[model samples]
Target: MKRNNTFFRSVWFIAISGLGGFFLSLTGLSIGWMIGTFLAAALLSFLKPSLLRHDASKKGVPKYWLFIGQCILGIELGQKINLSFLHIFKEYWMTIILMLLLSIFFSLLSGFLLWKYSKTDMLTSFFGTAPGGLSAMPGIAEEVGANTAVVSIIQTMRVFLVILTIPIFVSLWASNPVNHVTLPAQTVSPFEFEKLLWTLVLIGIAYGGYLLGKYLKFPAPWLIGSMVAVAVVQSFGSLFMGHDMVSWWPHVVITLSQIFIAASIGSRFHKSMFIGLKQTLIVAFLSTIGLIFSMIMCAIFVSKVTGIALITAVLAFAPGGIAEMTTTSVVLNADSTFVIAVQVLRIIIVCVILPPFFRLLNYWEHKKHLSSHASA
Candidate 1:
């Protein structure tokens, strides 16, 4: 009976959150469904004890649902990979490398400000400002012995602000009106069996890659792995078949995935995370603003140097998650392929480079403390 009630409550929460998303979508906000559901779930979490019954059960959206969402996102991103994008990368390799370095520098600067002003520990502050995927950073924070709650909250807040602000800014700044591009319809194979077989093969590849990535201890393994796997398979298949592989991702599936992901992230908040709330929020907000401003300047420089569109450069440099930024690029009819590639490369670089540097910092701090203690 207890289990049944808990299940029902969880369902109710998801339903309410989805409704919030639906209403927000009506308002024409970028990523409205995700933003609305996240806000709604977060409000419920915050108000559980005061306005809501104390006995109301708190439950998160299932973890697998979040994983499923990641897989779908990975596949969608993978579909954007092609020979033409590779050509773009080769043409702009130097510019891309410069942009990546600038992004990392700005992130570190934000992390330092947070550490200096808010007294957040080094690891937590860095991870919170790292501009990696929201789902990935908190886990990395915990692995590095940081406060996961603080990291999660700061990361989420930063993403929310980026998503909320960038599109409006771009629309206003661009000389032409923002045009939304409708995705082309999927090209289905004439043979039904062949289509089913191709989809099954793609799923198999995603699963296999996910397992392999887990074994190898890759960062955000499932997402990165699935994306790489799908891209490889699609590329090979296209070479043999003489046409691009069509994505199975549909609008409804993507929206549902967004809802699930948003609800999960929202439910992570706890009242305990707010213990030093004002200071934390102020630092996070300011640091995020600083990061955004830095990226905008970098984008302008890149645009001028490389002759890429300013909007495309900005989207590529925006310190937001891959899914959110890519969606924005698609909606705003920017260079989504470039945005995804740059964002993915940035994530890989951060994950690979930050941990060792953090460990070195920890080692030095420990040594310094021990030397002082010995003198005392």
Candidate 2:
């Protein structure tokens, strides 16, 4: 019972942190709140690396909670997927490619600069400088004996700074950053207890699937399975039942859900683990230059090819992850969709590209060392 309570409390902390940051962003209070929160999360992580490190929770909540979040994202994304718009946007594909190449080029640059200046090995330094997940890269970094700590710190700090600065920058540059959309008040056509019961059953399915995923030691099992299952069902229902099957779901529920996400992300930051502040500050300066230079190149590339606008591409392709780019795009009034799509693509590329590159880098470096020793 005590352990269960602690889990609940921690999850609650995480959600609340997300909510607090979202509200602050909406109210225009702290453009930097998300970064502040992430920084706090890193601090929390350093202090208690196990704060939300529950393999169980990581395994469990997504089926029930995270699945719902993904559906919302999909719904938003699906709504935006216009065939006509895409046809027009098709010409921009080459531009997107150019933008992607620019990201890769700059990522290489950031890696090289870090390698030259720092004691970290080229391979670890290379992957460590990657932008997506601090967790994902550091693990890869350590396997080959790269400076995982430096990579972890640099990546986290890069995310931290992006989250803090991007929104403020976007809002400053955008034509009209705050354009809140109000949804129509929902009214259900009729009550069907049978369908309601089934929806509850589906939620239960998600719950159980998440738990089972934990047992299987799957990564984000809850999120992956629940999202896949619910999405499949939801998509099928829309195809057959004709859009009215899920009318009764509440906005209040969604808002609350988003808050939970924000808080959970925020609680990642605790007050400890900020020792040797000068070293952190120095690395932060270098990382900032790298991110800025990379973003500027991306923005210029988008401007030349897509002709969509410079600032939007820059905000979208900025090396920071989804949360920062999404929030900043919203706050800055840039094309959030464009920003998100590119960021998502960036993530996909990193997840796919980083591992192979790491392996190759190790092989090449090892061969180089052996050659040098033989010559000596």
Provide TM-scores for the models. 0.78, 0.56
Kindly state the number of residue pairs that clash in model 2. 22
Q: What tens digits encode model 1's per-residue C-alpha lDDT throughout 1-376?
A: 8566655566676667778889998865546677687778777666652222234323355455556766766665565666655656788889998899989889989988898899677887888898775655664565567776688678878887887788778877778756664533424335465666676778788888788767877555566668778777877777677776664444676677667766655565566556776787799899899899889999998888878988889999898877667777776778888988888767756765776676678678788989999999
Candidate 2: minimum summed lDDT over ten consecutive residues — where?
56-65
Score candidate 2 by TM-score against the native.
0.56
Q: Which stretches of candidate 1 lie over 4 Å from their true place?
A: 1-9, 46-62, 133-149, 160-196, 239-242, 321-337, 347-376
- C-alpha-based local distance difference test score of model 1: 0.72
- Compose the digit string of candidate 2's lDDT tens values, residues 1-376: 8667666756655554454446555644232344333344344544454545354222222223334543343332222223322433465667766777777777777776766665556775677667654424544454455554456567767765666665556555667555563322334335577666755755765666556655764334444334334544554555565442453344344444444333333333333323344544475458666666667766865577657766677777777766556656555556766776676556545644665676787798789999999999
Off by over 4 Å in 2: 1-91, 133-148, 164-284
Q: Which candidate is the best by lDDT?
A: 1
